[model samples]
Target: MEHSDEWTFADCFHAQKELYRAIISAAVSIRWMIEHDFEVPTDADLRQMEAEVNRELCDAWVEIYVLALREWLDGQ
Candidate 1:
């Protein structure tokens, strides 16, 4: 468990370290959900109210990966 002020950044030598891992973790979870058929059921009916939220989640995962990679490379 981590106990630090959310607004604070940790010390950096080569890098702050935690940023990349947290971003990767979230991306991994989203990928797993998609690969495991987490979005099998769909709310496609207008009467039932509908949207492909899983699609959006996957997009968010890609965005996270991009941010993580950019930060890591910049630190190097």
Candidate 2:
């Protein structure tokens, strides 16, 4: 996956460092959600619980992609 800001990393080392952080944060958030039983809020409550859930999911995905991309870059 392509990072939102390519300028953030000048070399593979930087990418790996950044990705490690992303992975840790994602794992924590996902674990919290799972432990709390994140619920899919209804349309009536889209602005509340549902929106938060969506954000969490998006964050998780970004972290995973970043880590995978970092690994790929490392091999290059």
Candidate 3:
């Protein structure tokens, strides 16, 4: 989504949720790295990983936007 300085309450909550999800994801990755030697993946591997991650994040953002829009429309 495009950046904005103004954030409503629900937007803030969604932002926080996204941040928390990212942190938790990072923590798991870090734990895995600590347990084993991390090796760089091939270009194809990177692309696949990126695609999966992007899809998941997009789904999350869609959910957030849908909820926010629903609430906004309800108020009208």
- What's the TM-score of each model vs. the native? 0.33, 0.34, 0.39
| Per-residue error (Å), model 2, residue 46 | 20
lDDT of 1 at 73: 58
Worst 10 residues of 3 by lDDT: 27-36
Q: Model 1 over residues 1-76: C-alpha lDDT tens digits?
A: 8886433222332232345445545665566557767754344332222123344445565555555566555665
Which ranges in model 2 have alpha carbons more than 4 Å from their true place? 1-10, 39-76
- Model 3 C-alpha lDDT per residue in residues 1-76, reported as the tens digit of each score: 9886665657755765577468555654565456557766567755655565566566677566766667555654
User: Which model, 1 or 3, shows the larger TM-score?
Assistant: 3
Model 1, residue 31: what's the lDDT? Answer: 63
Q: Model 3: residues >4 Å from true position, as ranges?
A: 1-6, 40-76
Candidate 1, which segments miss by more than 4 Å at Cα?
Answer: 1-10, 13-15, 39-76
Each candidate: how many clashes? 0, 0, 0
State which candidate has the highest TM-score. Answer: 3
**Model 3 alpha-carbon miss at residue 42, Å:** 10
- Give model 3's TM-score versus the native structure: 0.39
RMSD of 2: 9.4
Model 1: per-residue Cα lDDT at residue 38:
71
Candidate 2 — which pairs collide? none
lDDT of every predicted structure (CA atoms): 0.47, 0.57, 0.62
